[model samples]
Target: MQPNFFIILSPAALEDLPATYMTSFFLPREEKRFLNRLLSEFPAITVIEIDAIVEQIQSIVDRVTQAVELVLALVVASGCLVLIASIQASRDARMREHALVRTLGGARSLIRGSLAAEFAVLGAFSGLVAVVGAEVTVALLQSQIFELPANAHPWLWLLGPIVGAGLILAVGLAGTRRLVSSPPILVLRGTQ
Candidate 1:
């Protein structure tokens, strides 16, 4: 006859009884201590091995990490697209204005300088908005999320808008070359 062996089970163990029982055997020292403490209060039970608990925790971590990385990639792609579109639109808009300026006796260098100045102003404004938005976003996230710490840096805020403005200026300059080279009469007539 087999010796009667007592089994200690947790609430989670009861839910997964079939699987737990399939792997049930002798308990480790830590598990035995926990079981003894549990059994002292309750009567009948089954014990879950530590290996299963460790595996479940590891699975949860892997899933969460995968989800976070997917979200991060999506955000980066969206930002890149927005920046590209903004630069393209800015270049198109400035090309027409630069053509008009050249028609009205504006020097080529002056037209370029004016566009650069406009871009600088836009960049400064965007930088200010980004800084403010970052502060507000960080504050809100810190207040709402559990176990999350505020970790905003000033350089990121400064860089984003400066880069945006520089990109816009660069694209605008590239697009205006044809307009700048055209004769004033042709520019005025909108021929090319």
Candidate 2:
């Protein structure tokens, strides 16, 4: 027999297909019965090959995943740079605070502890805001643009906040090391 002709039928053509062919795709029960009748009359017609459809879907999924990964990497890198710059700029203020603590008889270790705690709180707050903003954006896009269900995984919420907080904490601590190590008097004099 000749290669099966692929007839791409619209939803309106559902009533014309046989039940056997209709069952291969997602059709209502009523549509399936009507299709069964048509297929019984025409044995030559087969529904589209499922394997080909699956392969096409998989290819699309792979491309989408790659694109998403690339975008995510760029976003993360940008966030890191912004965080580093913000922390670096605030070093002088932090050093002044550290110097005050030292003058008040706080040890260097205690000064470091205070800085870490401040950064941790900042990280947590920033993470919370970022997560909420992202969730709202995704929800809006799904409902308005995609016209699809807005179901986000729990892990997304958890991961975003955790990652954001961790990134902030890591960058803050690393970037402030120089300020933390300087002499308290120099920091207070604004000489460093």
Candidate 3:
């Protein structure tokens, strides 16, 4: 039985309780032989090996960790795909806008700054959302599924936005580098 299911009481207070209640023990490897002897001599006595329980718990934790990692990788891959598709879909319109901006005295630095700012805001907002979602999931998993105390990870607050902004900036700049660097006249002509 889990510790959560019952409260400890004096023997006299539990006189009405059944005799079939269980007691758990922790013993060293050498002492396990003592437990085995006791179990074999008394058919009613049962001894469960802690090593087996630990191995089972570790296996479950490992499976859950792998599943979470897989989900995260899939999310990142899908986000990249969506980002690329959005950029490609807007390429023609963006080229025209870039040409117009440059034609009206806007420098390449202006376009670069505009692109960087757009990506940075998107990344930061997404990161903030991801952090919140992750913390909620963790709280649920710890308190309900694992029956453990819930704790907050402070590092997520710092790392989430930083990583998000960095990733978005790298991909966004790579995709838009040509828009910022191409000759405005050539882009205008191509658009026409």
The top-ranked prediction according to lDDT is 3
lDDT of 2 by residue, 97-182 (tens): 87888788888788778777777777777777877887888899899999998877677777766776777778878888887788
Kindly state the number of residue pairs that clash in model 2.
6
Q: After superposition, how far is residue 57 of candidate 3 from its true place, in Å?
A: 1.3
Cα lDDT of model 3 by residue, 1-192, tens digit: 355575778999979867765777777877767876787888887667879889999999899999989999999889978898899899989989989999999988999999999999898887888999999999998999999999999999889988888888889899888878888888878853
Relative to the true structure, candidate 1 reaches a TM of 0.47
Query: Which residue segments of model 2 deviate by more than 4 Å?
Result: 1-47, 145-148, 189-191
Q: lDDT of candidate 3 vs native? A: 0.87
Best prediction by TM-score: 3
Flag regions of model 3 displaced more than 4 Å.
Answer: 1-25, 30-44, 143-150
lDDT for each residue of candidate 1 in 1-192, tens digit (9 for 90 to 100): 243686777778678555423344666656567777876786556555667788999999899989978996796457556655665676545556777787677898997687677666765666567578768787777867644777777787778678657755565556555655666665447564
Report lDDT per candidate. Answer: 0.67, 0.77, 0.87
Descending-lDDT candidate ranking: 3, 2, 1
User: Once model 3 is optimally superposed onto the true structure by TM-score, how far is the C-alpha of residue 129 displaced, in angstroms?
Assistant: 0.9
Q: Deviation in angstroms for 154 in model 1?
A: 2.5
Report the poorest 10 consecutive residues by lDDT, candidate 3.
1-10
